[model samples]
Target: MIKKAVRMKLYPGLKEEYAKRHNQLWPEMKKMLKDHGAKSYSIFFDPETDYLFGYLEIEDEERWAQTANTEINRKWWDFMADVMETNPDNSPVTVDLEQVFEL
Candidate 1:
């Protein structure tokens, strides 16, 4: 399995909404992530900077990218765009993070 992490900026003052949305995430979206070999997905928020950090474990990077192209993922992106920085297609403007150390 490969571990991946990404960073993005969240819209100011939307932390609560962001957390609430994920807390009530759709079932279909969850299933899609699982089907795409995604495991232990998590998101962390930095209150001071409003930066969002996401991490996940995947079996195949290619499959993971393909999974995000699904309708469920698209819908999730659209739903989240209101509280996060997103592109025209509703995808977050993400910065890939390099893994330096893991214990």
Candidate 2:
């Protein structure tokens, strides 16, 4: 498995909404992630800066990229667009993280 991390900015004053949304994430979206090889996915929030951090492990990078092009993924993006920074296509503008250590 390969680990990946990404960061995005949350809209101002939407921390509680953001947390609530994830806490009640859609079942289909969760299933889609797992179907596409995503595991141990998690997101963190920094209220002071409105920054959101996400991490997950995937079995294949190519498959993960392709999965994002599907209808379910598009729907999820649309659902989240109002509260996050997203592109015209509604994908979050992600900053990839480089892993430097593991035990």
Candidate 3:
């Protein structure tokens, strides 16, 4: 599996709302992610900065990327747009992190 990480910023004071939404992630959305090759997915938050760090292992990067275009994923993005930084398409504004060192 390929390990990946990305950084995303959240709107101020929406931490609880953000977590609430994710805690109730749609079943279809979760299945879509796994179908597209995602595994061991996790997200972390830094309360002080309102920044989110997402990590996941995937079978293939290209396949995982396809998850963004899925209907369930799009709905999830729209649901989250109001509480976080997102593009015009309602997709989260993310910056991929490079892996520099690992043991």
Q: What is the C-alpha lDDT of each candidate?
A: 0.92, 0.90, 0.93
What CA root-mean-square deviation does each model show from the true structure?
0.8, 1.0, 0.7
* Predicted candidate 1 versus true structure: per-residue lDDT over 50-72, tens digit per residue: 99999999999899999767999
Give Cα distance to truth, residue 36, candidate 3, Å: 0.6
Clashes of 3: 0
Candidate 3 clash pair list: none
What lDDT score is found at residue 66 in candidate 1?
Answer: 97
* Candidate with best lDDT: 3
* TM-score, every prediction: 0.96, 0.94, 0.97
Model 3 Cα shift for residue 62 (angstroms): 1.4
Candidate 1 differs from the real structure by a C-alpha RMSD in angstroms, to one decimal, of: 0.8
**Cα displacement (Å) at residue 48, model 2:** 2.0
lDDT rank, highest first? 3, 1, 2
lDDT of 2: 0.90
The positional error of residue 7 in candidate 1, measured at the CA in angstroms, is 0.2
Ranking by TM-score: 3, 1, 2
Q: For residues 1-103, what per-residue lDDT tens digits would candidate 2 score against the true structure?
A: 8899999989999988888888989999889988899978989999788999999989999988887788988998998999999999999888998989989
Pull out the clashing pairs in model 2.
none
